[model samples]
Target: MADSPGSGAAFPSQSPRTKKYSLTEEKIFYMNCRAAYLTVFKSSLENIISKDQLYLVLQHAGRNPSQKTINKYWTSQTAKLNFDDFCVILRKEKPTSKADLLKSFRQLDVNDDGSILHTDLYKFLTKRGEKMTREEVNAIINLPDVNADGKFDYIKFCKLYMTTNEQCLKTILGKLEVDSKLKCQQFGSHIEGTLERDPSPVPKPSPRVIRKTNQEMFSNKGGSRSPLLSSTRNFKTSVSLTITMSANSNQNPKLTEPNLIEDWQCVQSKGCFFLEEDGKIISHQYRMHIPEKSMVYLTIKPLKLSQVEGKPSPWLSVDTALYILVENESQANLQPLCFTELQNREVFGWTGELGPGIYWLIPSTTGCRLKKERKPVPEEALLVYRDETGKLFLTKEFRSALSDIFEVIDLDGNGLLSLEEYNFFELRASGEKCDEDAWAVCRENFDTKKNELTRQGFMELNMMEASDQGGDPRDLWVILHSMGYNKALELTEACPFVINIHAEKCKPRIKAVCMEACNGQLEKTICKYVLTNGSAKSMDGYENIIIYTYKHDSWITSVIENKLDNKLIIHVNNELSKNCVNNKGLNTYVVEVAPKSTMVCQHVMPLNERQEWIYHFLSSIKWT
Candidate 1:
């Protein structure tokens, strides 16, 4: 009474028969037909169905069709149908019974694991003489692998299989549209019979409406173009068309533009923004639109070590937190606008709605807490930003040299530097010239008694030097040099202070002065120099003195040299200078150096009688 299932005859009794079947029965029938088609065709469901395969499926569905008829339909509609569309056609054909559907599923589920695995499916297809690559088999498994765990659950598989048909059909139709347009543009001729004979009943809009829609879809509206769709003109004819089609579809008319919707989806999925070459938001979000004000989209990419010049330290990693701080032009201090704590190699972005005004777009990696007690020291922070016009800018006054230096030297990141760490930093900053004398000076002046230097202490020391009373950075250089931080003085002069101390040229002269005054007992001597107008009349005039102490004889000595003439003018408590003066006819005078003391010295000594200090000043020297 009913045409054989494979006979090329219309299902004359299908309407009455379909009415008898419940929804579940119909679904069973659809799944049976789908299983049969997949098994018989020996191909994946997601793969494009060939014309001969479609014809065979049509015949099996009881839609009787000759070769000529099938060809006409295939050419008129999409040349190929994906598995989802094939399932839709099977549903239209109606199901026989639930028993048959269960049997078909059982046949495919050979391993009977309650779900289908790619390996199981592959074996089944191979037994059926289907030659498919591993990639094809995996693609089929992924079709129903909604969770992407490499396997398909039976219930989820069925639900997704049925619901995704419309989306698949839309994607195919969009591809066809793009292909047809490309053909028309290339050949300047339409395929005569193909379009007119299309079997689907999608109503066509007028030429004017189509043209207007195309213009709207392709127009570059103020936003940045998506990097994914950058080369739209070069898209493949058969690629997954993400654009929503307008022809006879239920999609919103205003949202017909593919780029806008696709871009938004891209950003939402990635949780980050990418900018095009023209500084436009790559994945622009249309939903984030604000009224009367444009959105300022921000994106920051983590740079590799090689990308940064003179990177202060290697502690910076790809996962470093980046922040964008926004401050009003009238505000004196910087305030944070937004921040992103990204994973290693992650791109960060933010969108903000603001009116036209001068805004500071400061950026930082330092996680400086805004609490009153945890505020960042301004001198140790680096602030970079961009303007409204997208011109990159930075704060020239905010120096990070101290922070960079500290970070490089603080190997343990404990906010404190041990003597070794401080010395290492000093060596790096100033080189080998940062000898014991330099460290001693640093420790004494900074009160680093426990052989530790806190970050705060280092910052204060830097600040004190930077903002010194004379505004001469070399003043710190002189102090550091006197403290035996010769290398540190040099480095400070070169980097943060940027002074030309000529330390290398002065090294030999200073060393020779110490050797002569200390009788070559340089290791037992502590030398300190003051750069000042050496004239006795100048208030800043000070003696160039070396305080020497002998470890062997417990002898103390003070060697004072004339700054202007390099003359060894006087010695305090120096047995050698005293012996040389007494034995050799070295011109000398007895001068009172303190309230109750006198010392023999050359007459050329650059000191007033009241200021002529004792030769034993080392024994009475104040620790401070």
Candidate 2:
């Protein structure tokens, strides 16, 4: 998973240097750059904000800044950063208030016109004072101004901003390395310079060939003095903001307390009066463990009420929750009860092998306030994997945020998903899940019987979910039905491919006596008889039977033996029916071999073209 929201370095809000730059500096810089582009292009600023850009900005390059630092200097912080610095932004604290957003917006509107006129938009832009042509503004307004109103307003601006921001954010999030586009625009020249120095670009690493030289450079050689080791030791110091909620009011801690490992402080605020590191916040998260098998109730207090900012609310939930089965404490090590199970509930009681330990919870679009009210004892622990898991896993708080990527690819929850089911998540956003080579890569790296997946699978699936879809696999319900399954839903909480569905035309049924035979794959090669009416009628002077066989690893071959009592038979294989050809009065029989099978692994009838396909449709069928 990517770094948790709270793991990034802090930029102190009260830094002496920051005081020199007004909070509007950052927003003004960004708005100016955008205005510069718009001015040069003679277009509205609408296209300037893309989804990818918004997501990247929201994540603050994946850094989390403190609310104090943000409220203090948000308007002044520039989005421009070297690739390394951009990453630092993701951990910064996200602005969680409408007031803060309006402040940021005002910074963008240099003229304070409640609108960004093409001319005013250019004020902060650094185009060397280049001006936008009137024609350009007209064109931009025409394409984006759905209302066709003469001038641009907040509604139109927002529509355009959201559309572009969604696209840009996806692009940025999908990247495993620096964006090729960004690199091409910014560092392409630098790379060329490096190539000129070496006359050869670094060779790409192959799976089979390990780069021993690079490995050794990073490896710690006991008591050895090396340049790399020297560089590693030269690092700045950092501290964590800790909070120990105590019952006594007199116990309030101070920054100078002896117990303070490093310089730290606290504030008595209405909400979380906890310690916070000094720094600008980019994005952040908090994870706390609830006792295993405890009854959990959760609720979120809205941090922001406006969509003025480009990305979704930064306050988000984790993907999976742990419900450790305490009785069989041995299983607790697995974190067996992942967030997938507890994601949807504001309150619920779970009984299981909750080993004695801490279990973390993540709530979405809001922080969670958990109150445990139950004890764990003898109830058998049952695991749940469902729609809620998809929601939970997307948050930075969950360790398994990327868990959906590697879930088994069965969109129909049939214990298997074919290549088609697997692709559903890959063909989504471009590079977030896997390289452009995801389809080929996953095929080479998946399991069949166990339906296992790898990290590559998870990334590909995750990228898909977070992109065009609602960031939820359940949204792919249509895709699932189109693929021959019904009621497509998410698999376990953290897995995208482990779906549940019904086949339109499920297993074939045998209402009357007939004869059939199948090979291991059930191709339906031969048939002696098939049932036409509800009953076999009078076979008169004919007999029928069905046979199936397969081989074992060592020597033994398993064979299914049965006799044709002419009681009931359903023809599955077309070939089998053909073989039983032209019986006419001799009692004609038909058979066709379809891949349909039961959950218990019994070979059942495959649906005919006329029936609506489903996976377990045979559940209502009467059998002897």
Best by lDDT: 1
Tens-digit lDDT track of model 1 for 192-232: 11212112223333324432454443464433222112222
Candidate 2 lDDT over residue span 220-261, tens digit each: 333222221221222222111111111212232211212321
Give me the overall lDDT of model 2.
0.26
Candidate 1: what lDDT?
0.32
Please report the candidate that would top TM-score against the real structure: 2
Error of 2 at 12 (Å): 28
Return the lDDT, model 2, position 516: 13
Model 1 vs. true fold: TM: 0.16
